[model samples]
Target: MRYRTQAVAYPYWVVALLLYGLQMVFGLLAIVKYLGPDPIRAVLPFDVSKAIHTNLLIVWVLTGFMGAAYWLVPEESRTELYSPRLAYWQLGLFTAAGVTAVVGYLFRWTAGNKLLEQPYPVKLAIVVVMLMFLYNVGMTIWRARRLTTTEGVLVAGLAGAAVLYLPALLEFDNYTVSIFYRWWTVHLWVEGVWEMIQGGLLAYLLIRLSGADREVMEKWLYVIVGLTFISGILGTAHHYFWIGVPAYWLPIGGIFSALEPLAFLAMAVYAYAATRRSGLAHPNRMAVHWTIGSVIYSAFGAGILGLAHTWPSVNRWTHGTMITAMHGHMAFFGAYVMIVLAVVTYAAPILFGRPHEEHETAIGLWAFWLQIAGMFGMTMAFATAGISQTYLERIIGLGYLETQQKIQVHFLMLLATGILFAAGVALYIYDFFFLVPRGHREPTPWPAAEPVEA
Candidate 1:
């Protein structure tokens, strides 16, 4: 079968492949710096590599969301994208701006605000790109008249993305005030907006893969979004403790952030329940692997480990240490990045009009397991290092510099784990792009929908 390159799935594969490649390269660079000598850090500084790592993550995930939206929206609404040309333009502009911003960060041009450090102009460019994307998606939704569960979630995410930027763009002198709202952007977007996007995409995937009832999946979507907002909005307080905020914020943040994990837990249960209720033969085994893996890992890694640091007592020791990275890496990967990858896997064969090779699916599944194992190993090593550093710095009255030196071996272990992750990523890229079944001229028949249990 000759699969059309312009199919809805093509954009997703393009974005996923590009991001995976960048992620492997920069992810390796990050690991190498910590394991290598001081001179190596000079060549590839922490700040630069961190910027590349985080931004690549953000851009690629958003690109996946875009592709998902483009594919799912039209299918659900029974209409073509309102403007493919606009989408293409948005993609081109975003790619250019993202590259420019990454380059600027690599050379030390930044706003110096941790996650929000991209320079002013770059931030402005991001905002513009987002607005353009919003316009395109919004118009598509309007023209379609028929709204799906996923469309609602996607719109909500886009709205949250727009609103989250308000505080970062505001002029503020007091770092405390700036930091407070910074979490609104960082925390809210991840816990709130990204959660919505994940929920929507997961629902769409389940509908396709499991032949699950759209109504049931839609209800799950509402519950997920409701829990996310209820828990996630107040959850922003978790970051307030160390940022010179009121002492009262500690308890509020701790309690609400603790509740945030419940949403994820519910999502995992719901996905499993729905899939089991619908007795369908999933066409893509790798999609099932990724979907189930994402939900389970998010529940354990994001929910369980995240709860460990939500309290003031535990957080007091965990803050500014490798422990936080453990949570961030696992949670983000499990909750958001994995969902995006799953969506790509689910959509790719349909977009290409071909059945993916079983061997390739098996390879991708192995790569998934390896990546998860690597992340788990790295997080454990970091947690150990963080606790050791905390004891040395706080209990033993050792200097910060001395404590870092004391945990050098743990950092080396983290570097090794990162290498494992890179290897996993390499396998994934090969399995998806190079090794997967492709280049079909005939359209494959859509799989029969199985019965859905009441």
Candidate 2:
């Protein structure tokens, strides 16, 4: 089938890698704006840097999701995509739209929301591109030869792409409505759609890498997807707690948000048990490491820190502070970004017809550690800064600007941590693009021997 070939997946990987690199660059610029002198702020405005950071993040995640779709759709459907040409067109449109939107934001054309700041036209273009992609993927699945795996997960992710955009499209002139729509996009994408994608991709990877029965993995996939949707839809209420929504939302959001981590934990246990019992035919250490990191960080960041702010009492103090940002960065990067990277790593070797170089794998693993450590360090520093600033401003009645100056030192620490993250990204990009092995390698035959368990 045409989809069985690497050509369908190669372009997705290329775009993902490029966007990943750009995300890191923007990350560094954002850090510079936060830490560097006022002169640096003039060159790289905070709004521009923030827009770049958020937009780059969205681009990389989408790129990775596209690659995962290309890789998994063929295997699950047992058929080639209905039209690779349509996929190419989707890619072209999305790339053009993403680039144009980011440029527009940097040039000051924006909607003014923190994460949803792209210009109106750019937002419309994004919606159109998403629709095109949805149509192409939907058609491919419709014409598929089979649906042996968890089609629900795939459909859920696609549905999320559209559903999450609904609130943004709602015409409401009020800032409250704007905030509601913003969270609809933000919370649903991270806690809902991304989770579905992660579940589907993980199921596919587990089946391939662990040599586990597809049926068993598919069942686990159903459970994962079920939990994600059930929890995610209600969990969005957590963000509503401080947003001037109905007071009744607090309990609903907190309860569901608290249950969200259980899904990831279950996934971890399932992977470990499956691998241990089935005997991994291809125990890709890099992939395993990334997957494990994703679960651990998500559980801690989203589950634990998320619970910390679920209460209105706590959120009243923590909302809009660096503490919230700290939680968001770790949870999103760990849950979504790492899962995407794992899928890419798993599929890249198969598509390339060779294992990635051992050194490259090592580099990726090292980058994983660096990013986790750097993010942890930044989160701790920011949390401390946030609490201290809050107490100084609210409790001690310090001036807002004075409180900011007081926290400036902590931002310095955040900058240093960001540099470490940037270095790790550099290593990741270098290893993934320039150093990983490519093309076929001659198989090394072994003498006849007894059958091994693996």
Candidate 3:
């Protein structure tokens, strides 16, 4: 923690981690609902459970992203946060909004949009929170006048996410129009601006953890951003394919979506090249592991798996199936979730005032590998179930319920793997809150490394 104001990020991380644990709980409940005899169907139905599960995921990951930015921006700008009080207020209000939205969902108070299910008031609250956040961050950069490309890209991504969310606030009378614009928020987010966020965080991690050249890493950031816009922005057409859009979108979406992998591939190459070129190891090996793991997993999950289904021909069958879940689980984890964890793990020692060498705790390693194994198993389960569903229902002409019944075995696999994933999440939460020191025991200034030119 170079600046005293950086301490503000601690509470943000705490909230994010707690919400992450809660998300896993809801996810497990969702899987059980899929596999079961309906013991609590009247009280906690599958739709509500699934909605809570997905909403919690988005909330926690965004919380993590904000926390990471709060941590990163000050360091990059070489100044204290412009307003710690404002940051805390933003966290509190944002959290309240999220919690209120979740509670409301239990009672079925929602707008019924898939990801944008939050009611109008909650959406307004979220917009207000984002405004507060951007104002504080933007002011900090202006005061310091030292915005690095890394933080610049990060802030831009965050701003774009806020702007893009405005479309979700609008309601359309036409279902096709509603669905079309909904993708403007959903697809553009995870695939577009969120990729920029991932790239920014990835560049920061690679440079710091590997002692990689700032110039080289920043250059890679440009390439990643360029690739993301070139592929991701246009890739929005892919979701429009079956949404009663014009037929021209079919070829346009396929071509651009296919090119989407180039961004993730560039990130993978960026991390690898940074590590190899620097050849200087940071003591925080677990952070390095996560940093590297993010790019590799995303390449396969977000890039490869996404491409596998985004084609008009394939997605015509796979959309809204378990296959989407398959890609979503791994892609979100790899691209957004892992990068956030990378920053958390990297900052843990400084935040807790522990020696940097202490970062590779036994519990941390277990948490990392368990999550990897669990998510891998979950993806496999979803893939098999989706394939079977597509064939049994889409091709073999079975009813949806009949198809699901046939795929019960895969649901069993999902439950088992989901439990493992939940366990990993539990370990991570425990390590963060219990094992880590509540406050600094001793003065521990992390030694700054000289940048190694690549």
Candidate 4:
């Protein structure tokens, strides 16, 4: 590690990896519950397992994000962390809250707000942790007397995410009203500010990994951000289609949400363009694979799949069906999960003091393909199940349980794919933790690379 303080990220990333592995466990469990007799139905219900699965994903992704910032900011700012001490405290608070939330779910203690299930105290703690993290991050940049657009965009996104969460802190009794504001928090984060974070990090990784001109890359970053804001903000209306909202939102949502894919397309183009310009001179080309993989997969998942069901007519049929799950699985995995893993792969050498030559290995390649194939199969499984369910239940007017019974075959397929995906996830953790690290040395001071001229 360059900075002694960079070691702080070790615990952060470690916790993230562990939680990520546990996430797959719950995910597989939920899928199994769908496929067969519920041996543990009385104790561990599907809803609880699903909730834990989803919540763990959020916590771990955010943890990975925070950890990435800790590792990247110092090198970017040309200074050590403002307060490693604060980073430690923030991770502790974040981890504790995650653990408590998981434990509480087992006991059925929740706010029951559908995905915003973290209890009030835990929510408050999350806010505090964000505050600490942002303060440390902000102060670090401030102290360095330097800030790149890449870093600026990243910090802004993180700040925006923290602000958006405020709405989740409040409660509403009316279902319509609650759902309205709930989108403000969830949809806005996923479709809005979080894209900026992804764009920023994507820019950072591509520039460093591809040997591309920083100016051209950041210029594309600006375009991506502009497109994101243009589309994603109004894309929020897509959720308003059947939510007792005004008729105007139907057209507005369809128009803007469809455009949201444009930004994702631009991101994929941005990564590919940068890499082609440089001819992949970077030794850790596998990291480049991940970086570029995130871009294209996100376009396919979030952009293409999202467009598939985003229109009002299409959503009317597919909204609450397996189609939603299909799109969600690909979108989240493609956009958020892959980007985080991209950074983890790219930064492994720097973070762990390994030689750059050891960046990507054969095992890493295996893990990557297994995951990509597994997730694709899972998406197809969901797509088939959803289509059958929609046709049986909605179109043919069959009862929900009866339709589900008819679709049990798809559930079995889902379990099979889930197991495959889970294995890939396991192999990833194993390769990242066990095989990636073999020795350690005194912390070496890594000097910032010379600036790439405009």
Candidate 5:
């Protein structure tokens, strides 16, 4: 590592990987429920398993984001972190709360809100940890007085996400009121502020891997942030379609949410243009692949698939169906998850710096391709199932259970593809954690200082 204090990120990264593996475990279990005769349905119900899967995913990614911030801030500012101890403390506090919340969910001790099930106490703890984290990062930048645009956007996104979560902490007696507020935190995040976080990291990764000019890239950052806010804020109306809101939201949601994809499209173009300008000079082809892949996949998943059913007409048929699940899997995986993994892949050499034969190995490539292929297959399976269900249940007016029975075959296919996805995840975890990098090729030291001749 270039700086000793960068070691603070190591533990956070380790925690992210561990949580990632656990998340996959629960994810497989949750999906397998669709294909069963589930023997353990009583012991581990689908709801609990799915909750754990989703909750773990959120925790792990946020954990990855925290580690990325710790790693990036110091490097960007050209200063060591202000307090490694505070960073560690923040991680511990966050982990303790997360673990407790996960355990509580298994025992039916949740707030019963989808994706916001963490009890009030757990929510408070999250806030505390977030404060500590922001404090450490904010102070580090202030101490150095060398904040870069990349880091500034990232911190703003992090703080905005924290502020958005505040609404979820309170309870509402009315379902309409609750659902209305829920989207404020949920939709506004994926479509709004989190995009800033992604854009910032994307800029950082592209600049380093593509040898892109910092001034030019940050200029692109301003454009992206502008586009995200322009479209994303009003796009919250998309969720307002069926949430007991007025009919006026229908057109507003369709119009604005449709524009939301422009930001993702811009990201893809930005990454590709930057890389092409590099003339493939960077040695680490794997990092380049990840960087470019994140951009394109996010565009397809978040922009294209999201728009597929975003309109009120299409959303009416697809709402609360597997179609949403399909968009969700691809959108979340391609957009947020891949970018986090991209950062890890790019930083792995630094984190576990080793003079290996190739920093980007064939096994790593296999893992990446396998995941992409498997997720595509899964998405197709869901699409087919959702289409059939919509026709049978929604259009044809068949009963919900009857439609489900007719679509069991699709669940079988889902299970099959899910196995492939699981395998890819397993390989990635093994390649990253098990296969140690031995090339700690530190830069050579300069010769001893010599006295200047008079």
Candidate 6:
């Protein structure tokens, strides 16, 4: 809020939260299909609903990331944004493309390649949007002639994400080849570059919320980014195992996949050390809760649960089961979702002219805890369902359909927990849009600005 252009982030957040709410709706619909006979199966089929559910997650999270960057980069660079106009255009184009792709999927107009189901044109539009985003952000930094390591890592991650997505645009006739490259986008994203994005945001949040020394925090951030590349790049081989890849990938995947948790562990330690050194004295207690929660939850969900099934032997049994879903739900929530929420919570007071010292609200607190409890419950539900599935279907050789019937109870748990999670999301959306005041406060310099080396 120190800069006038920072206001551009508000609209982006508004769009992101709206999409988040819509995503929960489709997610509920998708789960309902699993628990009972489909009433609207013909009109809104499970495949379509599931695709929309997954795609919305990616879109809304990306939207949140972009908005966070718009808010953070200006402050980090000690200047206003390079072009707020360009940023708004980018958001409009990206949102339009996302909506078009989702609508197209409803009519069965898709590439039908799992998460990369967006058609060719939609993909191109996405690439262009990314270009615009990077250009605007890059120009902002260049003009300021100052860049912090925290924002540097973040911008690098966003650039890498755009580059990695190029592989998805290529057309491969071989099914195995297509699947191989698909992970380049999907796995490398959530597991690789996306982690860098999470780390950048984490460092920024810790520095702002915990009053952590910027010098020490950025130094350790270097280590976390190193671990991410060391493990994440090679960990792509893990996905290659089940595919028609060489036998060498099994060991390579297992070893590197096992090492992947190191990055998440480092993040957890990073947060802990910061909090330990600088006690939680920040007025934005809600953002602190979210920031700390993101690191701890990610360490468990992304690191521990992921390591559980990612090994070659363990994965051979639980590769495609609800176990992956289990790991995915919590990991995505803790790593990406929570971090974004932390930024939003931290910035809301500044953006809306509310007093920073008294920004924490009862509604916000409930939203945070509800999401934590709900995601934990949902993860357990998926874990139980996955374990049951692995035993009955994979081990006992039960037919898929029969195993599904036996696991209906677990699906019930999933639905019930999913509703809890959805309610939390609803509350968050309401808190952001309705509860937070709309009056604008005059711009003021950040009182706690720290010296930067990088």
Best by lDDT: 6
Q: Assess candidate 1 and give its lDDT.
A: 0.77
lDDT of each: 0.77, 0.73, 0.89, 0.87, 0.84, 0.91
Query: Deviation in angstroms for 71 in model 4?
Result: 1.2
Off by over 4 Å in 6: 438-454
Q: Estimate each model's TM-score.
A: 0.93, 0.90, 0.98, 0.97, 0.95, 0.97
Q: Is candidate 1 or candidate 6 better by TM-score?
A: 6
Per-residue lDDT over 1-454 for candidate 3, one digit per residue giving the tens place of the 0 to 100 score = 6777887888999999999999988899888888888899999888888888888888888988998899989989999999999999999999999999999999989888998899999999999999999999999999999999999999999999999999999888999999999999999999999999999999888888887889878987998999999998889998888778899999999999999999999999888898789863788888888898899889999999999899988888888899989999999999998999989998888887786777677888889988998999999999999999999999888999999999999999999988888898899888888888754575356545423222
Better of 2 and 4 by TM-score: 4
- Global local distance difference test of model 4: 0.87
On residues 117-160, what C-alpha lDDT tens digit does candidate 6 reach at each position?
99999999999999999999999999999999999999998998
Off by over 4 Å in 5: 355-357, 437-454
lDDT (Cα, tens digit) per residue for candidate 4, span 194-291: 89889989999888887788888887899999999899999999999998989999999999999999999999888878878876777766687778
In model 5, how large is the Cα lDDT of residue 219?
92
Ranking by TM-score: 3, 6, 4, 5, 1, 2
> Which of candidates 4 and 6 reaches a greater lDDT?
6
lDDT measured at residue 6 in model 5 versus the true structure, 0 to 100 = 71
Clashing pairs in 4: none
Q: lDDT by residue for model 5 over 261-337, one digit each (tens)?
A: 99999998898788777654556666777777788888998999889889999999888888888888888888888
What stretches of model 3 exceed 4 Å from their correct place? 448-454
lDDT of 1 by residue, 260-341 (tens): 8988998898888888898546757788878887888888778888888889888887778777887888898888878878
RMSD each, Å:
2.7, 3.4, 1.5, 1.8, 4.0, 1.8
